[model samples]
Target chain A: MTRFRLGIEYDGGPFVGWQRQENGPSIQQCLEEAVAATVQEETHVYGAGRTDAGVHAIGQVAHVDILKEIAPARLMAALNFHLKPNPIAVTDCAVAADDFHARFSATGRAYLYRIANRRAPPVLERGHVWWVPAELDAAAMHEAAQRLVGRHDFSTFRAALCQAQSPVKSLDRLDVNRVGEEIQVIAEARSFLHHQVRNMVGTLRLAGEGKWSADDVTAALAARDRAAGGPTAPPDGLYLTRVVY
Target chain B: MTRFRLGIEYDGGPFVGWQRQENGPSIQQCLEEAVAATVQEETHVYGAGRTDAGVHAIGQVAHVDILKEIAPARLMAALNFHLKPNPIAVTDCAVAADDFHARFSATGRAYLYRIANRRAPPVLERGHVWWVPAELDAAAMHEAAQRLVGRHDFSTFRAALCQAQSPVKSLDRLDVNRVGEEIQVIAEARSFLHHQVRNMVGTLRLAGEGKWSADDVTAALAARDRAAGGPTAPPDGLYLTRVVY
Candidate 1:
């Protein structure tokens, strides 16, 4: 059996999420089905990130073991052909080491949150961006975001359903910048607690609106309670941009 | 009646075209309906350009006459509320002079055509871009695009049913640039014939593929026949970006 690593790009607006579920389709089930169709064998695909519903991914990584004797390019082409009508594309494929694990082997992961900071609602970028009607101060958001960097118990930012055993994770980078009418919040770390990025963005938006200061963000982090944090930003604007190994 | 000029943005995927038709919905019909619902009067909306089906717009200009006394921002907000679920937005609105016609008063227009030049298909931007699976030489395309930058008889690029009285239109700019994995073609002109930009892009793609050169493009332009030019590019990649008054 050969283990192949796949680079995936998907619009999560349609799927239930990354993991398999009985209520509706998920990215993992669709990918596994595509692989089964290509290799004519039941196989499991392990993903690097378990993105939530309505969350997109541009650089999602996955690994699958198959018994088919096909070229990586051929397998990728075939899988894409089968993944048709579903907004998912297998961009890259290569033979991976037998010990390679898509989740456990990943050393770093990055996320990008996009907010359309304008009075006019987004038409073309409707589902891909969070439309905040208020004019946001991106510089202030950046300044306040610096306070969240480093290791801390991110209980205020953690999701209730998060499976991570520890809430303390080291955040390597958290930067905010405005590109035209869109405000981009980029976060990088070895890993993240569930809903950490969205929770952080929601809290930073208060700072962008001049409603909260850097010291308030520091206090929220110190509180270590979800109630003290801001609301969770919608999953529509979140994108799993990269998973570094 | 007060004449109001509107700056509009829309995803043209669901519409028949900019003009009203019996077959299906149109952008003009939707905007007119929204205006009627807002002011309780039937009115006409004149657009700066008649964009084809599947073409998008970020800066499309239009005008409407209404009897209601309403602020521009309030009108814009009400129209947006009424245009719900449709991928259309009235970005800006302002009172206009009696003689300011949306179609006649426009001085210049700009269009952007995006091509995803990559092996993988676009997932997030599926309908918003044209996917070209081959590597394009953007510099070569840019070099050849310069040949079409002057006033010329463009019958070679004109559509058969184009209603323009003459095929002579001066093109101010035709530029090709590579942005990441996407090839962007920007065209600016006072006006364009039916499918002029798409035809030019189709021919330029040949140059990008190393199959044609600048001289070949000049020959095609000089032929004065649509059959001499390459096929028309898909409307999916075309976007009406700006309108200068």
Candidate 2:
């Protein structure tokens, strides 16, 4: 058996997150089904991260083990041929050693959140970005985000249903910037708690709208309670940009 | 009556085109109906350009005369409130001179065409970009595009159903550039013939794929016959980016 690494891009609007669930369809199920159809073998696929529903991914990484002797390029072509009509594409494929674990061997992950800070709702970017009518102070949001960029116990940003054993994680970067009427927030980390990025974005949005200050964000971190954090931002604005190895 | 200039944005996946077509719903009909509902009056809105079916717009400009004495901001909000559920947005609105005409008074129009040069079909940008499986030489495409720049008779590229009286039009700029796996072609002119941009892109694709050479593009241009040009590209990848007055 040969193991293969795949680079995936998907529109997560129609999916119920990456992991297979009884609730609805998932990116994992789609990939596995495509692979099964191509190789005529029922196989399981593993992804580096299981994104939430309505969360997009441009460079999601996955690994699958198959007994087929097809080349990497042909495998990519055959898989894409079967995955048609669905908003999922395997952009790249490569042979990997059996030791390469898509989830365990990953070193970092990057995320991007987009906020359209204008009166009109997004048109071309519909279902892809958050629409905030009032103008946001991106500089203030940046200042607030800087306060959380370090190794810390991010209990305030952790979701109540988060299954992670600990909230302690190292945040490598958190940046906020504005371009025209759109505000972009970029975050990077070795790992994240459930809804951690979205919760932090919600709090930064409050600072952007002048409802809260940087000190308030600091206080929320100190509170170490889920209620202390701001509301969770919708999944529409979030994108799993890349998974670094 | 006050005339207002509005900058519009829309995803063209649903609409037939920008014009009022009898076959299917059009962006013009959607916007007009939304505006009429908001102001309680019938209004004829004119757009600076009429994009084809499946062609998107990011900064399409339009003008409408309304009898209501409402502020531009309020008008924008009300129209958007009614235009909801449809992927159409009035991004900006301003009071314009009564003499302002959306089509005639426009001094420049800019368009962008995107091509995903990769083996796999696009997932995230499925409708937003054209997916070509063959390897593309962007440098060759750029060189071929330069041959079509400046004033010339673009009969080889114009659609047979084009309403323009003359095939001669000044071509201000046509630039082709590659960004990672994407190829972006930007075109600017005061006006264009129907299917001109798509036709040009189609011919350039042939050149980029080694099916045709730069000299072939020049020969096709000099032929001055629609049959001499390459196949017309689909409208999905075209975008009416901006209209400058």
Query: Which residue pairs does candidate 2 place in steric collision?
Result: none
Model 2 lDDT per residue over B28-132, tens place: 999899889988889998999999999999999999999989999999998898888888999899999999999999999999999999888998888899988
Point to the candidate with the largest DockQ: 2
> Over the stretch A1-245, how does candidate 2's per-residue lDDT look in tens digits?
99999999999999999999999999999999999999888888999988998899998999999997989999999889888888999989999999999899999999999998988889888888998888899999999999999999999999888999899999999999999989999999998999999999999999999999999999999899989999999999999999999
- State the C-alpha lDDT per candidate: 0.96, 0.93
Cα distance off (Å), candidate 1, residue B103? 1.1
What's the TM for model 2? 0.98
Report the first chain's TM-score for all candidates.
0.99, 0.99
True lDDT of residue B81, candidate 2: 87
Chain B TM, every candidate: 0.99, 0.99
Error of 1 at A40 (Å): 0.5
Q: Once superposed on the true structure, which residue ranges of model 2 sit more than 4 Å away at CA? A: none
